[model samples]
Target: MKPRLPQLDRPVRMPSRSRILAAVIMLAVILGPFVGHLLGAGHGQAATPVEPLPLDSLLRQAEDQSPQVLRQLLLALVMSLCCTAIHLAVTVLVVVSYESHSLMAWASRTPLGRITLIAGTAMVTFLAMFVEILSWAALYLQQGAILPVEEALYFSSVTFASLGYGDITLDLPFRLLASLEALVGILMAGWSTALLVAVIQKCLALRFHRTDHGSDPTTATNP
Candidate 1:
């Protein structure tokens, strides 16, 4: 007799309601400040003026202060890695939860359902990115690199998006961190895009498979 192989169709474990509630609370904590910052934008006391410096001047300063730049770069890299890991975790959690609950099977049955799935995934991706930006903003605020909560959030958002609107700028010593954030943002954006594509492909495949086999595409044996 041949040895039994592990089953590929083993049931996925859905997260409990308590786990889902915890995840919701965590998202609220991460995104609350951003919502508050937007709502209270004009009501708050004026942020102290931060003069923007020319890029060339900032570069020269960084060159002259190699040790400080190196330290800041290392810190930025560490933060970027942390943010990436957090983003990946969020994406995996969402995908797994959806799959475990057979949401993919339900969504694959209709065009509208597929659209909703894609839209929901996009929103989650945006939220994850915002959470990362807020983390960097919190770091900037804590370090006294940007004093006002609103300004820190704004600077971090623009920096992370690589917008560089020139309306807000970090000091020379901390400027390298902004560059790192921009790089991370680009990578995360690409990652999110790829995730969306993969999700769409899965949905399409499941839809076709269910149509042909007359079986629930997401069905699995219970453990």
Candidate 2:
């Protein structure tokens, strides 16, 4: 036989965290103005040009707002990080519980059991998300950014879901915070969807593996 070339078996490496963050920031900077223009266009309003401020006035305004801007950024970061941690903790607990019990493992083999598992997981995740939304609403209420408890919760729910009904709007000070909430919501929603897909995929894989070997699913170790 002729000499055979060796196959490359190396796994692909993922981008580093710093690179990913840089890319995101770069994309946002490039796209931000275009998105703002589109949003303004949707409002059917004409842009009005104002006289430019002097350098000293601009610097003074920036200095005055910097503290508030930093505070809002910190708040957004903390809230998003907390929500991420909560989601991860819940996911780990669920996977551990499913793997630890033989009954759960065996049940995952059947259609009905798998349906139940998915539904339970959905409900638990929903509750977690609801709590997160409530926390944000409480913040808005405490800040008096939105009046009436009901309205605050409504705005929080809509923003967190990225629905953006636009019927209700936060005051100028909190508008940036709301935008941050929308971003966090999008990320959390994607993460939850991924978790559901992973659970379904794992269940299907386990079912097929057990069916092929004709072995007890309970005795099969989890990946």
Number of the top candidate by TM-score?
2
Encode model 2's per-residue lDDT on 133-192: one tens digit a residue.
Answer: 998898888888997999999999999999989999978889899999999999889888
Those runs of model 2 whose alpha carbons end farther than 4 Å from true positions after fitting are 1-49
TM-scores for all candidates: the values are 0.63, 0.73
User: Mind giving the per-residue lDDT tens digits that candidate 1 earns over 168-210?
Assistant: 8888778888888889888888888998887777667766776
| CA lDDT for candidate 2 | 0.84
What is candidate 1's CA lDDT for residue 112?
Answer: 82
State the C-alpha lDDT per candidate.
0.82, 0.84
Best by lDDT: 2
The lDDT of model 1 is 0.82
Question: What is the clash count of model 2?
Answer: 0
